[model samples]
Target: MHLFSENLAVEIATYYRNVALGHSVVPKVFTLVNGSGSQYLFFIDDLQMERADEDQFLAYIVQEHDAVSYSRGTLVIVEKNQQYIEFAVVDEDDSEAIVCSAELTRDMDDKPIGLSEFEKILVKRESIVFGHLYDPVKLSEEKIEDFESLWEEMKPKILHRTMGV
Candidate 1:
């Protein structure tokens, strides 16, 4: 099945936006297919991250989601007491997965655009799969150092799972 549909993304975003109002953090929505033939739309706020211990976090997720089924074209909302809400669809399998996200933003440029200008904008917003994308507003070097440290802490754990070491 196609991973992303623009219309679907907009609808999902809108629905979550209402439910997520007044939350401390911008809610994150993730569409994932598990090892089983199940698909899920997970919406979680970062605030929950602050209070959850490792075991509580694991338990919360495990108990909240289990193998379930949904109609092919129906969107089901799950009301669970946890960090985020979930919508589930099952009976589909995925060997590989890719993610796409979209946000409507006002164009900041105040100048007329020709072909060259348009190409520049596209390049600026282009997604980079393996490395950081171009950012007009650069982060401070100190901030970069802090981010690098955080990445280092998780890098080995990720590599161990992804590389099967």
Candidate 2:
């Protein structure tokens, strides 16, 4: 699919804003499929990092990776847990696998660091990218089921608050 970056950006922004406003626990990201395939990018949210553990962190990466793989597109997971969030890309084609991590560091002058430093860090994390292939069609269907389950779980809480039952 020929995914447009702008559309993806908008989706990511909207998702993030909703999450920030206490609308949902769903991760903020955009998923689009074009003629070529599908692509996703999780927006970095510094505030959400506090609740992130290594398992959740890794699972998030794997989830995105699987999403792209299933949709036959590319997935980019942006890590907002740290001062400098990193973007890690995963491709469906094994041969196209190129893992990189970049950190945004500020200099003494309060200016951003150069691309060279970013590239260096990206190169260093190449060995960490690992995950199984995920089918988007199946995942999409499963997500619907999950959402319904979530609604069911919240029904009691909502009723309790509204009716004092």
TM-scores vs. true structure, each candidate:
0.26, 0.32
Runs with alpha carbons beyond 4 Å of true place in candidate 1: 1-26, 30-43, 50-64, 68-92, 106-165
lDDT to native, each model: 0.29, 0.32
Top candidate by lDDT: 2
List, residue by residue over 1-165, the lDDT tens digit for candidate 2. 112322333333444334433442333232322223344233324214443332244343335433333111122334432233223333333333323233333356544442222231212222433323222223355655554454355344321111010
Best by TM-score: 2
Give me the overall lDDT of model 2.
0.32
- Determine which window of 10 residues in candidate 1 has minimal summed lDDT: 114-123
Worst 10 residues of 2 by lDDT: 156-165
Model 2 clashing residue pairs (backbone): 1-34, 1-35, 1-36, 1-37, 101-122
What is model 2's C-alpha RMSD? 12.5
